[model samples]
Target chain A: MDEPEVEAMDEPEVEAMDEPEVEAPGAPGAPGAPGRGVRERRLHPVTPLRRAWAPVAVGAGWAVHDPDGAYRQVTDLALWTLLLAGGGLVVAAALYGFLSWWFTHFAVTDTELRIRTGLLFRRTAHIRLDRLQAVDVNQPLLARVAGVAKLKMDVIGTDSKDELAYLSEKDAAALRAELLARAAGFAPETAQDVGEAPVANLVHVPPRQLAVSLLLTGSTWVLLVAALAVPPVLWLTTHSPGLVIGTGLPLLGAAGASSVGKFVKEYDWRVGESPDGLRLDHGLLDKEHETVPPGRVQTVRIVEPLLWRRRGWVRVELDVAGSSNSVLVPVAPRELAVEVIARILPGVTVPEAEALSRPPERSKWCVPVWWRGHGLAVTDAVFATRHGLLGRTLALVPHAKVQSVRLTQGPWERRNGVADVHVETGANTTVAARLRDAAEAELLLQAQADRSRTGRRTARPDRWMAQ
Target chain B: MTQQPGDRYGTEGSAAAADAPPGETASPEPVWRSLPRSMLTLRRLLLVVWMVPLAVAAGLLLGLLAGPAWAAFAALPLALLLWGWPLLGRNWRSWRYAERADDLLIQRGVLWREETIVPYGRMQLVEVESGPLQRKFGLASLQLHTAAAATDATIPGLDPREAERLRDRLTELGEARSAGL
Candidate 1:
């Protein structure tokens, strides 16, 4: 572990030394060394692919103007006529791409990250440095080939609001690190030169596992099977194979397409650790790069499908502040998932599997199916609720993240002397410990209420800049 | 909104409100205050004066267009209005709010009861608003906004002066005890 940590720290510094940086005077990091205006400096130029593809797209559009065959028209066209029209269209598109690339620029001020873009309707958006949440660097398949990346910055109270696209990969990585460090309140001079550090890889999924997981992770294949079955069933009754094939084949194709899409979106999934934050990269065509700070994660869930239960494989999902819900570890052995959880949440102790037994025997009447699986474990820092027999799910929510706790008893539950306790964390996640003894529910509610009080008292303030 | 910034309703007001039946503990719990009585009368008038007449006119128009039998539709609104008159009073009676040391408590509902406790420290903003009907009745509402999007706890049917005072008190306490996540 120490070796990995050291290697991770060295990776970025080594990479930064290789890249040549255009030093702008009076940059945000180099405070007081001011004479020149850093704000006027533009970002790295966008890749020429934008200009290269514009003409090809326009020409393709012209060629495919008619859905039916228009090859006769193409062949009959004069060579000079084709050159004049195609050349004009290509030049026009290339000019537009060039102008767009030239006009867009971003600047870093002490207080804010200013982005100026748009051609006709010029827009200048500034995000306060104090409110900066995370800086993501993404490289699509096309941009990867061109060695360019896009940087997306999320602010505390805003959504995906600002981005600098088509930057050299080195610049993108440097900017991402600098912004993140600045957000964390590290001084400008020391933190600014974080360009070269490479993230240390913690988990890498092999191709076989990725494929198997993709196939079993979602229920899209069920749709494919259902669609295929529909045609055969219809054939027995209507005997109109034509109509059945027409509708079912399209449905089958759509299901297949969606499954393939999910595979593409999650291809080459990787998780790594950097000095600034945890880095996650995925997607084959349109990539997504996300940085989750140490304290930004609110809740984590460990899910084990029925098929995976026998193998002791669990999926670790996390909720971060600025990005969508993501799986930190798609499918890992239970011990590995727990180890990763311990790493992510340092103080929270997850008990061994043997200790996480079923709820009290008195509440057996409330739970009929696989009653042995229901359980709840509470620690000073976190609480875990385990339920679901077929597809078991163990949800862990830090005490500080819990907004409220509810204890509910329906008519049947009241009769059986059982109640359910639900803990909510903002909008994204909730953990419910179901079918517990009514007395236990009351105790749990009170304990959780106390936990929330202590958690709030000790928790870090939401705005670090305010401190 | 003109607000008098002070603890104007001192111990005397809380003591008076705390005069509840024995067996319930005091001191730890703040005395709950009910909405102004005028609010109930205003609601009854709005239903009887505005809603019922509109329904009756619609019923009459339907009768003219369709048949005399359709005019009987007017009775449905009349019956509903009569049934809802006491419900409105009961709802007003059920609405109560208490200003606690650490949090504000709101309790409402006749059947499915709900009690919400909004921590003063968690408050992001405090707003006082009134519509035409509420203004006509000299009543306003105090809304407490927090980071949680679902928390819409607004204490309605307060006197405009009282509403402003409560808003100021909440704002002061919110700033003084600022613990946020």
Candidate 2:
């Protein structure tokens, strides 16, 4: 057997068999076929969708959007009551149809995974087994209640629109395992041991921390709750219970929703090695777990938001090649960042132990080797220099990994003699880090970009002292 | 109207247009060849200006029939607003993919006219696509997916028949490159 090429794992993206990338002299006939190496391309006759409530669900949803108007036309109480019952049935039937279609419409063949959809006129798309890169399983609110889940397979040919379904958790898991095995660079491994709750507890948060986390966010919901603040203040002065309750009710509801969301969204957030690759699972309404390999990672960015900075925390994101552009692990206690670098890189040189023992500068542009008691020797960071409260931000795109660099100076930035540099890295993972440099940082950026460990020592700059 | 950048030279890719460095070719396919005349849809320019306003006018006529003066009046501005999007599409670009011996060259970008060279050795996949319009025009665009993080070089625009021939060459080159790696 050919010795495996990539270290740790041999990761090759397996996009589903999309429209055949027919490359022969003619569009038909395989260049080499009648054998195993030649993948067979077949459009399966779609399995009849159990559509057996999608229309009902869609109709019910439409009715829900305009509730009273639906029955308001019926002045007769008895007639209105009958109409309401029929409406409810329609709604239930639609939900049932949606569930059935979502669950059973997907099929996994030996060489391809096929999804046949569209209500009136069916459309069938087959993604080749070898083309698949990764599979991401998401559980919406309905999925949890019904013990169903949605699985999305990332394949090379994008002609395949996203395939969504509401499959039984057991079936979804089995399908996921099976597809992962067939996908190139993926082999069936023991599934992750996610608990019943499979949620993160946000253990470090203190009591009354809602004031710190939620209120501080000033999210739209918080603003909605705050909008009622004035009326309550007036009512409290007048001592009118009706006015107070009316305004207070929404505030209570908003606060409850925000707190619960904050607590639930970050629950059981785990990022670690999976059999095929890295799996990150988080969120509530829709629980998402994504698997990606290092080869597919185009850019890796480590950021410290102001609040997280105050807590001495950081967030890591990967511009994944297979999935959506951004994959964020929202909370990390600095060490994990280093562990990530050490465990998941090619040639990373950890800054000297003594180098990390230095003090942090007040300016946000630079990350300190040490902040408070914490050590910071990260090669990648997006912090203060590009941070903003409401308006614009200046990101610090590191020089080493930039595929191509775009430097822009607006009239205002030009006036100030400042320029924003966007360093695009990797096609899929366009992780760009920008810094505020008038002219001095150019040498540093260029130096980092050209710094390659594998290159000959003779290729080094004339100023090379490390050798 | 939004005051967009009038024009600038530094932002243009005039300098990056120089021929690639020596010994860079990694595949055996030729990058440049003739293509069909039907690649660009001049008719799209008409729809780009016409369709949206027609729909808005139709909606406005209905509103006027329903007796809403304000809604009828809203049609003029709304139709203009709807039609404006496609007209201001200064950034939309066209591309061409050429398969040459040892490399796949992509010519793209509107004002900048940037051409990228992806030696077959560096490319991992060759993707070809033809949207509805491209199909009508008998043209296809090919994107070259590479393992490199910074940029996945792409070459698009080919006559349908030429696209198929080049696609085979690119695939062969990509396989050979991976094998060598």
Candidate 3:
């Protein structure tokens, strides 16, 4: 196709598979690619003007906190302060220019999406239009108002490297459209992270579900339990029933505050699929909205903090192509989570595993295991028996990516001959556990790595191109 | 576990390039070959970050001697140096891409030695990043995306023009290779 010729002239992106190279699909994108568009002009981008204020605000905040002795001397006190203020402004302006310059020029030709950034260290990268796996569009309140969006690209042959960062919403949409046109097999080995979008269901967790989402995770539970006990404790301290009762009322107030905080954090949580792949957006503090295509997923991890086990809730995530590259959905019903994951990786099996019984509600430490642990222990590590919060996690490292096996000995653990053996299962970022029997753990890590590799081997389709 | 007949996912050469005339390398370009290195610019820029704190402290101390009036002002070059050092260092440190027959070789890192090998057959896409400094240098860094690590396997430095050229070469190679497969 004509587009393939263009893709031929674009930069190659995706994973390193030892397959015979073939004519990759055209850049128009396969049917299910994300947003699609093409740049038609050589124009300077229109950058949002408000970004200059952020650093200024930050500078002001720091100045407030630093009144103590941060700026005592005046090589030119007023000038330096002004410079700090001005520095923020200059950075803001420069960045706006940078962003605008970037937004305007960043284009996806017939073959690749291009970016030219920086004045000194000029750099450019092209994602083969055909290899585009998923396009994730994120819009913050300000970005939305500004009519700009952040696009995260996931593609075949590419690991979880952060995709091009910012773009105008219109451009992002077009880019997605263009990408969707070419989202076919660019990599022979990995499964494309494509999913049937979840049917919109009205029965989603309501305001109450938001409360429930947080009831276990947020600090509200501890606050509630604390509130109930405070009355008697206050009474004992005051030797006055009335004073204790008054104190008890305040405890209840604290509980309400805690509940509100949690609700806000889980506000508008969603787990769904866009044409490209899984899209998830949640959290209040450092908000995160991300997407992952099936093919890019390297491994899967299912986590159930000990307390959550009672409700059969689990967290899901995939190490897409490397460490630091991941797609996570914070909570899912155990069964639904399994089903969702199974669809992405038909070969992977959840295997009827049961949660650990009577796990401590709050332990000092929570350890993540190499295998889904199946309620097994690798090593016992503690800053002391009294340290660490209690939690449980299950990590899945796809067999295709196994790096190294190691057992660790920390300064604290040295006194104990026990070592934390780590089974690193993935190409870039590997999951590790502290196995007490260092030698045994090493053997196990190697063995498990081998087993995972074997598992991956079994998942490959011999008739890969038939479809 | 009973292995199904088609369950064998992939063979040994799953993501690496398997077919190529043994040792052919990509042709080199003359226009955008080497990185621009000017020590004076490097020193002036890096001196900002390196010297900022000291300048600020000195500004404070000077305020004590010459008074706060001169303290903060004295630290300007210092601040710029302190902030600019690593920037220049990183720019200086990065290696550009050289298209190879079987793989893309990316050499980059400030202190740590990192060389990423991206086999063409395994390549997903190529990306070019141009930060603030890049524009000034008229340089661009071509990233060779491989399935290895999202951010790990990348070749960072190149002339913007050369980067575009190389991107084209790899994409064509990838297309040709992919089609053959």
Candidate 4:
């Protein structure tokens, strides 16, 4: 009912200041407070330059391509011509970017955050403060160099595409704190204290160790073997070094590029704890600062690759309700990973290997290789499952967060009297126990349903701060 | 496995049954409701509407270009229609839903059997939709949405009145047992 009125308002830019008080009665925060409503603000002026870089680079690359002589050195005239063309392209792209930046405006009211964009077909998106899930501050390499950051907000029941690009880093952080405070039901004046909340660093991943772990990954090994075997085989069969160069170079380049991407993406991963929630700061090229509100985590997964296991390392990933950056700790010692898990889901123990219920021996026909590794455990607080062959993954989902439960049986599984039980959550990480006795699977389903019912009854309230 | 209008499960009395104490002994045999058999007719009608024209066009094109022997390939759609006729009925029979005290159970799939248990507390929204064709046939489909996308439960081909009643009942239950994600 309130949404329609908001959407029907034609002149949001001129009338938004006074519209919220009458239209949205139940919206969070004090309505009609003097000087409390934030005025419409434009992004940093440098936003156009930062946004235009990608197009400028592409245009430069296109201008440099010569069809006449593929490997010919560029003449002085051609070089001058390329520079002039690139300059013209940059100016055109920057003008377009500036127009877009001028049209986009965002403002914060007592009740909601409103973002208006589009030059020809204007659109307005309203995010209720009460439904704000999390806030992320991202800085792309160019934006970082330009000293600006982008703010992304995750709202409940909506895909998170609401981004305020190219805000001053200080402004973005302050705005993030203000939004978090309002979402937590704090008054405007008291919201200032939220920004100063002390943070306790929990985990810091070393760059060298991260690089080593990436090298030890299965893909890297496959790429290495292919690189070693393909050149020799190509030489012997085709007798043309040119053919080897044609095919082998691109393959090696691609592998190298992906490995380099990962290395840059996860260069300096760090996690910290604050009174509000867990804080995650990561990336080398495009630095990202994400906050996972307490009780927002749906599932926790600990992965141990075959090679990582020998070094007693594991990767901890959390399926936070709204944010997409799920890596809690990319690579850490087993004990440190457990400690991080404990910090996230307090008082819940990770299921020990001994406590897991292994599938019946007769069900081994379903998965001969990984049957022994497959196990399921239903604890009072969480449902845990262990599976995977080359890399062992132990997934733990809090019973309170279980959205639904499912049991599936294929034709082959039916013949083997085995079934798979999936504990579904709102996040992508689903905890599943594969190849279990059909009878046990049925019982587990019922038991899980009952446990989830009780868990929901005793679980923390949605508004953690209010509690 | 066609359920007649009279055989439809009465929703009027289920409110009291559902409100009973959770501690009560579980129902020994929960009532399972099946989709109306008209769904089969609707599906078959759609299949014919889409395939007949394509089949005729294929037969004409092949007869002109590659000789009449190639026109035999046009029978593929007809053959598929005939194959799917009984398979759709069997799949329809396999579709059943049961409303338990605390949760709803939807069991489906003929080859890969899947049983989804969605707790009433977890239901975020309940929708009743009727397309133009379905409206012409006096039928509607009820969809149950939870936080998880994987909990895709849709009961298609229900009497319009029954679909509305079920949607109202489920919405009430969901509100009463609402839980945070």
Candidate 5:
């Protein structure tokens, strides 16, 4: 294994030489500089152990699934032989992991970041620095224990394969800063210390508030009601308490596990405003640091759950193109949510008491219950729509970010003279005004197209640093 | 003017007039172009190819398992094919695409009316695809992709030459008005 791994490590060096290398002139860290320029690095030495742990645990789980059969099979083998076989398996897995780790290498040049990995089928990704969208540092529980983190970079129009795992936590932070600085078009020596930049702390969610919010979620209540109602009903019908236990235990366990997972994932959520963008830091076992550049934010959503409404709490989430939907504020006061939105999207305000156009009275026949909550507001800068009955969702999409507009009507809607207009964005967050007057829907469709045309004309340039 | 079946759905002249804003002068009616009639034939041919095999298998199985009377089950696929014959035509006729000043309009569906307006500037990619059968039928499909995945608009069953022309025009417009997502 070691012999083959050493041979594979030499292959990327030969391949790298075949590609044209455009070294930046007067770059403080040029290709030849020992400490500064184009230094190719490998992941931490503990990567093999970390990589092998997952598959080993999965194998253990399968063995435990049928304990009796596993015991009989083990007993059939001599003790010494069984021990030898288990040791061999462990050695084989470790060798495989080590070989993979040995073959992987990454380097950051002036213009691009290059990652080369894979054993048999080598895959190389060249991510241009100018196209970088955001940088993130994530530390899972095991990696956290090992004092290592993963550096992930989001590039425009690319699916995520731009990740380097098992770098020392400190090294990950430094590398992230360096990459961000380079992406912002600063020389390596002149790059400012991003860590020292003043961050105005916006919102820090209390543990108590987070716990309460998780419990107040719609799924939790539904599960609670089912857990309370199903067992008793089953007992009355079947007269067997055993069947009730079998059915009720799994339901309770699932609900508890799901709630606990969410709680741990969102523990100690904090949002801050910095020059780079909105900084989000959260996680209990796995720490995550993410930055959302204001320019990348495509849409914003403020959600008011039926239960949280009375408490005047709302969850804020935003869509940043090239990345997944991220929670800006998991749970915060309405004012705090608004403030966060305003920071992410400058010059835009969340309408509080504005009278938005509601679907016509006759359209109510289609959506009897939700008709009242449905509303659409078209502003110069943003298009806002509100809907939902038990939980209200207010989606705000900037006209500049609108990708397209659509008008749809079903057979039922046609008879009711109602239609739905969808305002689409590059991200998952869409502003859909449901069940509006048919003529109004058509007008909205055309008007939104016009607005988006003008919006794109005056929109900011894609390169944030250039501006 | 004699009312065409499509006029009942308000897909043409009157719909465009109604779509204009209150104060704006009514813009010239967009020239709505329909898909080729050969597309209906292509669809019917494919339907027959798929249904014929299933009908034969059903007839043989029923005849072997039960009795000759149950062999009538083979008629189910035939019935579906016959029913879909005219339905496919309506669906084909329902497909219309118009390239406007700054955006492309695609109106489709029979029971559920859907109109997609994809701005030229927002288009990220455009593709022209043709299967072996479609090639034999002299047909190609033009697909418009935007930054938003939801903006899925495809104009199928166009003359191959027309598809290429449209693709080139759209790509040129897209690049000229390209607004980075």
Candidate 6:
């Protein structure tokens, strides 16, 4: 498999790029070749191995069920059943896979990527180039072995995700690069320039740091401390070894396993600067490469656990348009988290006291749980909400992304002369530093609501070229 | 109507007092429009007509299968008719919607009050639908779907003509506001 050396693209140009011209299948001049006059006509084919294996694997499972003689099945009879049933299933699956592969066709046009599949009930899904959000290339163990990869495109304003499964590894990479380049509105010659764009490695979570971060995050440390305190207390009170072992061992085991799970899931976490927005690549078994375009992120949360607060470590998480929650920085120093926030969202950052805006001190008494942990800072482009005692969170939501603003006063909050202001974005909503002064919350709600409307009205299409 | 002494805002069981501060609560009491008064009667009748047969069949099946001990569930229909009648009326009475310049507020619930404000600009799709029963009564529901899944708001039991007007107005506003995106 060959990796295509392609450059990053400009955001606005990506949006401005019109629907590309569809090439006839088998044209000589392919997308990769700049000077060739022949239109690229070859539609990449998908590997049929996945579909071939599906039914065979199910049949094999059935054949293997109750293999032990204790289950009253003769070994010879079972083997015969396995051979007949598994063989039949394999043949059936192979035919199905071949038919599917024969019928499925994918084409990358100037403006859109079209994928047509289904032997009888034909379905064709087209993904517009300008609306392309991310191009993910997936290679499972089998696909990698077969030298094939799957290309998935996430487009804006559509539910039908476009997938071109089982392309040759080289072709997949080329297609991904080509699509990204096209989205960025790059001509063939200029596309090479994007490849040279400096990729700033913001922070790479090391094994040691990841372990420390996991330990300090959420209830892992608390559970450990409690586990330590529990045996002593249980031993003194119950004087029963059975109960102690029954409860203590499982708790410790569960906690240890969970810590490892979290570490493994986020193994080799890396954050880097891409052409459009920021790219996050992580995971151990199934590697995930996510490209979060600018303005796609509706809400950004910076969390600092109780222990991590002292160490000045925080986790930066983002909620994009389609996805629920994604971690920008799983765990990093506060400075790095803040730096990432400022970089990703230029106009919005952790409010540092200076000439422009000071942290809201008037609403300090509203948050009774932990006043010090709660703060609200508003800027022209975004509003930042800071809250949490155990795990401190700093949520930065752009005014343009805000769908609505709500000022809620419950019986308890009203009694305390405090209220909560909620700012809702596309997918997620962030409360204004928890409970704030009722009067101030109301004012903030109105101001933020107006800001949201104004921001949407005046927001630029793309900030890349504008900046 | 003067508000109850214990209330902060004009909530359930609390009379709507004339005077209130600007920032203390939402402004101007949001000239609220309640659901059709007949919706309560329609809902109550539907509940009784639907539940009586269902409850009797379930009770009979249980009596035949696992003895009469389980047949006690049949009392559910009678209980529903007795309490559900008033509960439906209260719920129908509580359902109120107010349209502001920028946002639409829908308030419902008797004990646990819930107020949802769906900004007109944020609305992606507006649908006016009527079920068979509702259509028979010339009533329709106006559903507003926003980007946020949780923000999907529905106003039920509006006149069909009114629903159509609201839908057109909302769709127009949504398209106008979303043009910038």
Per residue, candidate 5 scores C-alpha lDDT tens digits across A93-151 of 89879987876777776556777677676677878665566777888998888899988
Better of 3 and 6 by DockQ: 6
Ordered from best to worst lDDT, the candidate numbers read 5, 4, 1, 6, 3, 2
lDDT of 6 by residue, B32-60 (tens): 89988667767877998988898889799
Docking class of 1: incorrect
| Local accuracy of candidate 2 as per-residue lDDT tens digits, A67-181 | 8875574444587787887788777765656533433244454456766555454466677655455677777765676676767787644432565565667766766766655
The count of backbone overlaps in candidate 1 is: 7
How large a fraction of the reference contact set does each model reproduce?
0.02, 0.10, 0.04, 0.54, 0.55, 0.17
lDDT value, residue A154 of candidate 6 = 69
Global lDDT of model 6: 0.66
The runs of at least 3 residues in candidate 5 whose Cα sits more than 4 Å from the true structure, single-residue gaps closed, are A1-37, A156-162, A187-189, A192-196, A228-246, B1-28, B44-86
Ranking, DockQ, top scorer first: 5, 4, 6, 1, 2, 3
Ten contiguous residues minimizing lDDT sum, candidate 3 chain A: A379-388
Q: Candidate 2's error at A6, in angstroms?
A: 16
Supply the DockQ value of model 1: 0.09
Where is model 4 more than 4 Å wrong at Cα? A1-36, A64-94, A156-161, A231-250, B1-29, B41-87, B131-137
Kindly list the per-residue Cα lDDT of model 3 for residues A1-467, writing each as its tens digit.
23455445444534333335321222222222222333322221434354455666776788688765556643337787878867777876778666644333354444456543444444545665444444566666666666666666654444433454456766665655444434433332232222233433211234554566567764677778878987878777778988877777777888886677545555666666543455556555434455554444555677666667788887666665322335354566788777766656555555444322122222113333322232322111100001112455555544434332333454334443334433333245445444244344434433442333234333432122224
lDDT for residue A342 in candidate 2, whole number 0-100: 46
Instruction: Show model 2 residue runs off by greater than 4 Å.
Output: A1-68, A76-105, A109-111, A129-133, A156-161, A184-259, A284-286, A322-327, A344-404, A407-420, A425-467, B1-181
* Lowest-sum lDDT 10-residue window in model 6 chain A: A1-10
Question: What is the i-RMS of every prediction?
Answer: 14.4, 14.0, 11.3, 11.8, 14.2, 13.5
Which runs in model 6 stand beyond 4 Å of their true positions?
A1-46, A63-65, A69-74, A78-89, A141-148, A156-162, A185-198, A218-257, A352-375, A407-417, A428-433, A462-467, B1-36, B40-102, B107-115, B179-181
Q: Give the range where candidate 5 chain A is weakest over 10 consecutive residues by summed lDDT.
A: A9-18
Clashing pairs in model 1, backbone N/Cα/C closer than 3 A: A11-A197, A11-A198, A12-A196, A12-A197, A12-A198, A15-A196, A16-A196
Encode model 1's per-residue lDDT on A1-467: one tens digit a residue.
11232234322311122224544544443333324344433555654446668678765797688634557776778999978877887788778777766666676654457776666766767776554546678888888887888888865455544677778887787887777765665545565764544678877655566667657754677778878788888888899979898879888887876677766766777778765567787887888788876656768889888777767778889876455536787777788778778777767767555556466665666666667788877766777888777787888888766655555666567677777777766534667787777776766664564455446666643333223
DockQ of 5: 0.31
Candidate structures ordered by TM-score, highest first: 5, 4, 1, 6, 2, 3
Best by TM-score: 5
TM-score of each: 0.76, 0.51, 0.47, 0.81, 0.83, 0.71
